[model samples]
Target: MIVRGKDITGPLRESADVCIIGSGCGGGASAKILAEAGKKVILLEEGGYFTSRDFDGTEGFAYQTMYQRRAGQSTEDLSVTVLQGRCVGGSTTVNWMTSLRTPEFTLDDWRHRFGIEGLSAKDLDPYFERVERYLNVKAEPDENHNPNNRIILDGARALGYSTKANGRNARGCVRSGACGLGCPFDAKLSVALTYVPDAVKSGATVYADCRAEKIEGSGKTKRVAGYVLDNERRTTKTDFVIEAPVVIVSASAIHSPVLLLKSGVCNSSRQLGKNLTFHLTTAVAGRFERIIYPSGGIPQSAMCDEFLNKNGDNGGFWVEAVPVYPALAALAFPGFGRAHRERMREFPHTGASITLVKEIDSVGRVTVNDHGRASISYDPGPKDIEYLKQGVAAAARIHFAAGAKEVMTLHARPTIIRSEGEIERKIRAASWERNSLALFSAHPLGTCRMGNDPQNSVVDPHCQTHDVPGLFVIDGSVTPTSLGVNPQITLLGIAEKSAEWLAENFAAVAR
Candidate 1:
């Protein structure tokens, strides 16, 4: 059953076959799979359950209510960007709903570079199929097109850049473009609407607004006994200790590592919070002769994968059109005052797209503060900066090709370029420094990586902590490396496979 509100402070009974933490795409999917397999499951979420009616389409209140640490404003060295969702559905509720399985090349790299033997594209294909089936994943059909998607289609067609409708996990969407602010329509198939509800129907219990502080367990065997949680009232212990013999950490990439460290499990490797990767994104905008309402339909409808295959020093970015509201657009545009206000009035004529760089080498670390809050330390490497420059240049050219009267590039000093030549020079000469430019990332991966070795990786191939026998991590934290795309589907696929593996192996491990 799904329990909501702040009344989580009362006595709680928590004995279950599996206790999963953080009910997002991973945790929710795991709960569904395990409960359906007849395992007594209890899912704990730190944020309360919120429905589409609760979404007010405003940034401030939504961030405070739905996001972690209040929209993850915490910074690392005052430069790196960190964003994660805290509610029952996690980032899936706040994300753009674009879903893609891990690319074949990424899986190949995991096998070849990371030595993860069984994690081939073919091995994961069936799991991805299962995930797609559960989420009802499909490309945005032609009838769902809004003005923002039309603008992207027109621009890509004019520039001769190959673009296609992005597959997203949503149903009955009315083309209202309020994704970042939160979808008011019950169209987005977030985990809260899909897996969480299904899990509840299958006899899984969910406790919301209960924050897990630290995991308490014994040594030698290194099995998690149970966790101490702050229920926004007082510290309370579960009525029964979980003799279930299985603990899964499905928290996002940021919190999972911190929780592991706090629990003193998997310290043998000490690789808990390293090798963080985010798909760095930058936006570029243009004003058209006609109004192109940004707030209509899904935020991202099409993507340009033309530059994805460009290897070596030349190819590094994937550009996609992203619909942005006036408030956010104003925040991204350089400069303030009357010019910004005027641009706000011209919101109907404005269009924007983001260049997402698949950065791998640039590393970041997630560290827990004295109070146990998670903080990150990251700086983009030189290679990432180069890719951003190339991506900006390419995006500007596409806009101009679409017959844009002028193109506005988002940089420390915004520049309006009228021609393709100007766009090239501006991007080529632009500063790539972290502080010199603004960058945002919706995808965070590899804070707690999975591998076969205990000395180098935090989790084993099955996502179990090498030292902690019963503890498993099934979130993005177990991703060996960055997947260079929306990781919701990939995470869900992993969760499904991991849940089945855990259910089958729980008896053996319990002994």
Candidate 2:
């Protein structure tokens, strides 16, 4: 049964065979697998549970209720806007529905460099297939592509670049283009509508509005202690404790390490909160002669992947269309006062594409502040910056080829391109430093990374912590490197593989 924290009063205590500390893709998948295995399970989520009825298709409401820190999360320096979901379903509920499998090259890199065994592309194929089937993953036909999406497709093709429709996890999508805000039509098959409900149906007890404070105990027994939060007032309504033999942390790349740090466990290697990576992202907007209605159809139906893993460097960027919503567009557009207003007037005629850089040299870390909140620090290397410049220029060229009247980068001092010949000159002149460009990261990964060596990783190949007997982490936090594509499908596959192993070996884990 699913319980709302507001419905409970005073301190409560519970026990289960397993306790998972998140309800996102990883936690939801784990809950379903373990519950179906007939293991008594309890799942805790820090955010409130809201169904399709609650999704109003408005940015104001969605950001306040569904997003982390009201969609204002960022690095300690406030340079990159970090978009993460905080509600029961997590980011899956708010993602653009672009689902892609982990590239074989990435899995190979993990095997050769990180010593992550038993997770090759071939080994993970069944899990990916299982998840894909369950989620109805498919590449939508061309009829579903919005003009913004067509900009990438037509432009890339005109430039002789490879582009394709993105695989999406959806059913009965109405093309409302509100996937980022939360799908009010109940068309997007997010975890809230699928895995979470299935887990509950399988007899797992889920608690919403419950924030895990810290974990305690060791050996064959462990206790997850936390407080029930009042979703509106942000005050503690009550405290709770759940004792279990097995514990899994799926609290995401940002919060997983914070929870571990607060509990003071699983850090023997001091690698608990290292190796953070964000698909460092920025967008370029193009102005077409006619209104594209950029916010009316599938938000991100296509992408251009010609530059991914370029030059055999294991790092490069891909381009995809982004939803051009008013509030978000206003914040991203470069200029002040009248200039910004003039740009906003072009909203109906604007189409934007984002460049997602898969980093190779970027370094990031997640630490805890004195107040116990998460503190993030990231430094994009020189190579990553150069790639950003190249990506912006390439995207601009594509816009011009697609018949754009003008194109502009999201830099503080915007680089405006009116002709193909000016793309390089304008983009090259823009400052590439932090605070000079508007950057965002919807995919944050690799805080508690997985590896065979305990000295270098927080989790082993099976996602179990090396120092803890029955503690495991099944989330994006366990990814050893940045995936060049969307991570939801990849995370689901990882959770399926790891949680199934845990279920089959329950006797050994609960000992």
TM-score of each model, paired residue for residue:
0.92, 0.99
Tens digit of per-residue lDDT, candidate 1, span 1-511: 8876444444554567778889998899999988988888888887767888889888876777777766655456545456678788999888888888887778877777678876788888899898787777888877676666666677778878778888888788776776666678988889999999998899998877655656666322323333334434444444223334677888888888888778766768878888877777887887778776776667886788777646843226788878776556776776678876776787878778888888856777888888776788777777877777888888877777766778877666667787877877777776666656667777888888988888899888778788877788999988887777779988988888878888787777544
Q: Indicate which candidate wins on lDDT.
A: 2
Worst 10 residues of 1 by lDDT: 218-227
What is candidate 2's lDDT per residue for 68-142, written digit by digit as tens?
989999999989999999887889999999989998999999999998889999999999999989999999898
Q: In the order shown, what is each candidate's alpha-carbon RMSD?
A: 2.9, 0.8
**lDDT, residue 267, candidate 2:** 95
**Cα lDDT computed for each candidate against the true fold:** 0.76, 0.92
